[model samples]
Target chain A: MNRHLLAALGLGLIAGPALAADGIGAGLLKSQCIGCHAIAKPENTSLDRLWERKGPDLYYAGSKFNKPWLEKWLQNPVRIRPAGELYARHVKGGTKEDVVDESGMAPHPKLPKADAEAVAEALMALVAPAELVSKGAFKGEKVSMAMGGMFFGKLRGCGACHMAKPGFGGASGAELYTAGERLQGDYIYSYIKNPQQFDPRIWMPTLNLAEPDLQRLTGYILQLGATEAK
Target chain B: MMTNSRQLASTFSLAGLALASCFMLPANAAAADEQYAKAARNYDTYCAQCHGINRNGRGINSRDMSVQPRDHTDAKGMGDIPENEILKVIKEGGLAVNKSVLMPAWGNVMSDTEIREMAAYLRHVCNCGSGK
Candidate 1:
């Protein structure tokens, strides 16, 4: 009878924190995140509606972000994109140059460690479509920076939008230096395959990249982001 | 003896012309080469991404873009485009001429003088004189 009592006590102790953590996460999502973030997958992908978004869509956070990075980032959030979410809206100055208006972009709210972890837990549950992310899009193919830059910079002109490094590339899109650590390899491949499927009104064109080139570009971007994360 | 003197004068004149050409030819050729080199450098930096390094509209970005970048090497196509039209495209971007907005305007980045130089450079690349 004593042994049975002790076993029940042990099981309760082990499961208590786990269950409480999930409950806490759910509560936080309701109170803190829903205001600016879209916890549920948004059906509207129109540019006009997209312009109204304050923060990045988190419906695919599970597929898109690394849990560790997301948790860490939530604790001390910083600017990710140089141009911010919508470059067109945030830009100022003369029409000829169109410089980024730093004043227009608001910083993300910081969270405490416990809250960050709980929030990350809630976010990580939001996975993108299975067919796109589950498929073996990226097979961990090795790509050299030199070769990747040939396709990305010299050939594709990605430098005109996304920055490869600080002050090196264009600011129309998000910086790619931290992509490796922040994003999953599969998500990168899937996003590149067809950005329109996820974001219909995005300025980014679908390259319809084939094998080897697709894998190579994914590997290159991952390598680039990894280098910066370190 | 008189015929020999006249022949000598003709030979000396021909020799002088050849010597003068030797000095002048390289100088002219060097200047022309320098202009072409500068034009190529500019084109590579700004236009090569969509227009291609070969100037053939087969740039790396060409795969995904719906509208094809204008091919600079096609004499027929380039010949139809006037010098002013080329200048407008460079200074105001493709949208200025009812073309693709994908082509960013270089007016802020490049000066009016630079835009004119680019037009001349395009002409050189096409090997076609100004359409007008």
Candidate 2:
């Protein structure tokens, strides 16, 4: 009788808090988020469905986003994509076009501190396929901003679309200026290596970079996040 | 698939309208408007960051870049470079024309027809070439 009672107590001690924490986070996500955000990758990936998307894909949040950043970012959500998700939809021009349209279409709603943590927990649970992320392994090489900047801008022409530093480069793509802080280095390497793998028919071109280019670029992006970007 | 098809159709229609304008007929006023509107849209998407939305070389990024992007609004400057040169520069990038390395080759992203349209649009903005 004593052994049975002890086993029950132990099971409650372990599973109680763990289940409660994860359950609350999952519950919050289901109620408040699934309306706009996708917790699961869609089965149909046609261009129409891509256009219909409201928020960036969070299905791979577990692998793509860092937990701490997710928590902090949720508390005060900000626009990351410069031209909004679908550039064609949000952009316009006129006599006085004021054309930058840097403040992407609609700002993401922010969450309170505690809610942010819970949502982050739920978000971080959304991991990508192991095969993809497993292929990525960041060496964390320390590359100088000058060298990486040259590779990104002059050689590869990335500066034409993406910002290397805040407000310093072009604005069509997501500014990886804060890449290290905002993402896992492995995810950055994997995504840069093959963006279309993540989202087929997306605008990011295939650079067909080899080993060093991939490593160097990933290292540089990580370094970019470590820089003074907010 | 559906949206891509729609965009492709829209592009073809706009191209046909642009072709009409090349002959100076413009088909109808609405079609001509659509062509220019698309030109403006493309410009806003690709070139405006460094070249300035006003096409006056005061783009938001201009303050930081060492080499200033060309002002499409400058008639004399745009006229000096032949329209063919503009097309080549846009398609092959500045390095091809011994211009600033900052200019990336849009050939990877934009269609040849789109690049041709962009060159013509530059002429329109500068009030040179057929725009005169």
Candidate 3:
């Protein structure tokens, strides 16, 4: 059994979208999205990497994107990336434009309204919420924050990449010591789980942490800006 | 007549041994060839991305990446990572072992057989083994 299969495996495998929706939405995603995005399978070749020119992977969209944002984006595509895809101009050498135009993103021509709703629901269902909550979804507590702070620097080594304050941590990844005050929890959670899923070809390590560890880490980091102390 | 029967039995046994060897030889060759091909392909698609086309950490994506992708061609660093550790990292993912979350787990993506093949390919490309 995988490490996720702990004895307290509440809700178990049925924890995902299968129990929430009739699956009509997931069925549509399978037809529409699977060509580019992978919910589970990994491979040397990915259609998203090839066809999109450059973009984020969507294997864990269920866990990464917020429900409302996902629904909105699906219905109306937006330009989230300022630089487009990083490797958009890799083949053409250093010359030529590199970014994908923001105006280029358009709504699916044939996605029915019903299917969109279903797809959104299905995708949202992909994340295991309870597991996230258990880890460290702290409503607010000084002790939790303090403990989280210590864990973040020494144990997890989050300081290695991120640019936290002088005593906070290092600068290997995004600055997240104060992520608690600035970014939303879901956004932080998704980014922490798989940075590249939101932004393709990102360099953050695909950390193999337990669900609880991830939630705790996310929770602790999210509270960084809210601590009210320097 | 007794001598003739004994000779016939011996010949049959020899023939059976020959047929078995014939089957085993081709099967062994084909299996080895298939693994080699898979290893080559896995290296081209997966390892080459971070390690560059030449098994060095100079791929296009490696430039802007926060942590400079490890130079697999660096004999010194490659020596530190054992084949078993590399296999574990590849299969379980970089973050699982508190290494880097950037390296995703291929367990969901590739099969065990594919992972084994990829492991063999890494050894072939790096050529570091237990030492640099």
Q: What share of the true interface contacts does each candidate keep?
A: 0.00, 0.15, 0.05
lDDT of 2 by residue, B1-132 (tens): 999999999999999988877777645655656868766766765677567667887654455555778888999888899767788888777878989877766666567888888888888788877532
Report the number of the highest-TM-score candidate.
2
Candidate 3 per-residue C-alpha lDDT over A1-230 given as tens digits, one digit per residue, 9 for 90 to 100: 65556733655555643555448877877777776566543564443354343334455556555566566556765433222333222222122212123354443334556766788788765653444322234333333776776666555655544544533222223445444433456656655676545434343545656666667777776566555324
The residue pairs in collision within model 1 are A155-B60
Off by over 4 Å in 2: A1-27, A34-55, A78-107, A128-134, A149-177, A190-210, A227-230, B1-29, B82-85, B130-132
Model 3: how far residue A148 lies from native, Å: 10
Q: What docking class should model 1 receive?
A: incorrect
Evaluated on chain B only, candidate 3 has a TM-score of 0.64
TM-score of each: 0.60, 0.65, 0.42
What local lDDT does model 2 show for residue A189? 86
DockQ measured for candidate 1: 0.01
**lDDT per residue, candidate 2, A90-194, as tens digits?**
544534332455445767778899888888888887888976675458787898889998898878777765778776665557878777889998888888777
CA lDDT of each candidate? 0.75, 0.75, 0.56
Which digits, one per residue and each the tens of the lDDT, describe model 1 over residues A1-230? 99999999999998886565467776898798888878777777654566688877787888989999989999999888776776555654433233567888888889999999988987887778887576577899788888998788756556656777776665656788888888889888888777766766555556556877778888999999877557
By descending DockQ, how would the candidates be arranged?
Answer: 2, 3, 1
Ranking by TM-score: 2, 1, 3
